[model samples]
Target: MPDLRLDTTDLERAATGLDAVARALAGTDTLAGDGAGDLGHDGAAAALRRFAESSTRRRDELGRAVEEFAGHLRECVSTFDGTERSLAEGLGGAA
Candidate 1:
């Protein structure tokens, strides 16, 4: 039961982290564009490239965290199902 709670907490934290990363990426997008067409070509290019790299790394980290959390959720579900089946079988129902 405690383990389940911990897993849930971890999942929540991971989700929050992803949300922060998404917001950061959005902010970067706003900076990457030059609304007045006054951006120096080289500087704009460098800024865009840097933003892209940072966004990519953040996205990858989020993806991995989500995948790990999903795996834990799957395991928990399977365990719960097995326990339910066992209980049903003990109660004389086909588990």
Candidate 2:
């Protein structure tokens, strides 16, 4: 028979990596200090400023999504670890 034990180390590592990715995504702010704010609030420059603002908002939304994904991954790993433990204990008793 083959050994089918669940090893959670890989999942833990993946969760850690996902967390790091989330941090990196959140840390990025490409237009944080862009001069769009200095532009006049009229004419074509106004439209450009609006576009920049929208871009910033989009970036924020994406960062939030990635962070949420990381959180979910971590939660799944924790659940999987607990389930693995339960199965192991149950199986040991049956052996």
Candidate 3:
């Protein structure tokens, strides 16, 4: 269904955004313990913290999007099952 396609697309986009956030977090971690002086350390720590927060938020958003997409998929399966049952019953009655 079109709705399912749209939901899938949205889920993919959210996943991609989360991946980018993860990459940024990894880059920040590389800056740690490099002994770049007090000011440099502070700046790197701040940047790392910001990246961590962004990653957390993006991960949360991705999780919610996955939940929504799964719900939609379940609904679609249930709908198809119901339709198949109804069609089978109709054919049985005719036979």
Candidate 4:
């Protein structure tokens, strides 16, 4: 089988980008609506509150998942780079 080459730099960059996305998602508290009274209708305001709450919950969950995935990607990059370095060193010593 052909050797599989991974660009660790690109992987790390992607993880960084995901971290930014997760941060943005984490800042969705504005969706919860602290002053829904200005909406001028009781039923509609309540419904909007419910929808906002649900959306905020889902966004928070998604943010956590994305952060976890980014962490995993960083770990993979570290492992791959370490293994490559060890292999190269071992080969040099054998020479």
Candidate 5:
């Protein structure tokens, strides 16, 4: 059988990385800028505004999803750590 090791530390690190990514996404401002209207052509400016709106929405959704996943990972790490400690204590008590 292959040795399989599960590391909660690695999971925590990954969760932290995800958190950073979520923060970065959430910090993003509009790509079109506030002066989108000054683009000269109304049609082109309108298109830019639409694209910026859509991108912002998608970025927010993705940020939320990433943060949620990171929370789940942290939960898993906590659960696994508790389980391991419990199991170790049980074994020690038995010995």
Candidate 6:
């Protein structure tokens, strides 16, 4: 029989990696704080807070998008592997 590879371990790892990255991004957001500690800095504090808010928002969106893309890739790999297995089984049974 011909070799028909249908491994999905890489895709699964990539999905996990994306999730980890998302979690890391969230961690950074948490670390940014609300600028409460710099309350005495006036303008600088407000500007920093604003920058942090926008950065957190963009990071969250980006992380979510990457996770979603990774999920899609994993699903596709699963479908492909399942289909390959089904085809192989059918052919084996016929033979």
Against the true structure, whose lDDT is highest? Answer: 5
Where does model 6 exceed 4 Å of error? 1-6, 30-33, 36-41, 93-95
lDDT of 1 by residue, 2-95 (tens): 5432354555566566556555544454433433235557777777767766766776676666666656666665677678779899999975
RMSD of each: 6.2, 4.0, 7.7, 2.4, 2.4, 3.6
Quote the positional error of residue 77 for candidate 5 in Å: 0.4
Model 4, span 1-95: residue lDDT tens: 99989999999999999999999998767544666667899988898788888888899999999999999999999999888888888888421
Pairs of residues clashing in candidate 2: none
Once fitted onto the true fold, the runs of candidate 5 whose alpha carbons sit more than 4 angstroms away are 1-4, 93-95
| Per-candidate total of colliding backbone pairs | 0, 0, 0, 0, 0, 0
Model 5 is weakest, by summed lDDT over 10 consecutive residues, at 86-95
lDDT of each prediction vs. the true structure? Answer: 0.61, 0.69, 0.57, 0.87, 0.90, 0.77
- Order the candidates by lDDT, highest first: 5, 4, 6, 2, 1, 3
Q: Which residue pairs clash in candidate 6? A: none
- What's model 5's TM-score? 0.88
Per-residue lDDT of model 3, residues 1-95, tens digit only: 45422344554566566556555544443233333344456777677667656766665666666566656655665666666668788888421
Candidate 2 residues lying further than 4 Å off, grouped into runs, are 1-11, 30-33, 37-41, 93-95
lDDT of 3: 0.57
For every model shown, what is its TM-score relative to the native structure? 0.53, 0.65, 0.55, 0.86, 0.88, 0.73
Error of 3 at 92 (Å): 1.8
Query: Residue 15 error for model 2, in Å?
Result: 3.8
Better of 2 and 6 by lDDT: 6
Distance from true position, residue 31, model 3, in Å?
A: 14
Deviation in Å, model 4, residue 10 alpha carbon: 0.2
**Tens digits of lDDT, candidate 5, 1-95:** 99657898999999999999999999989957566798999888888888889999999999999999999999999988887788788888521
After best superposition, candidate 5 residue 39: deviation in angstroms? 1.4
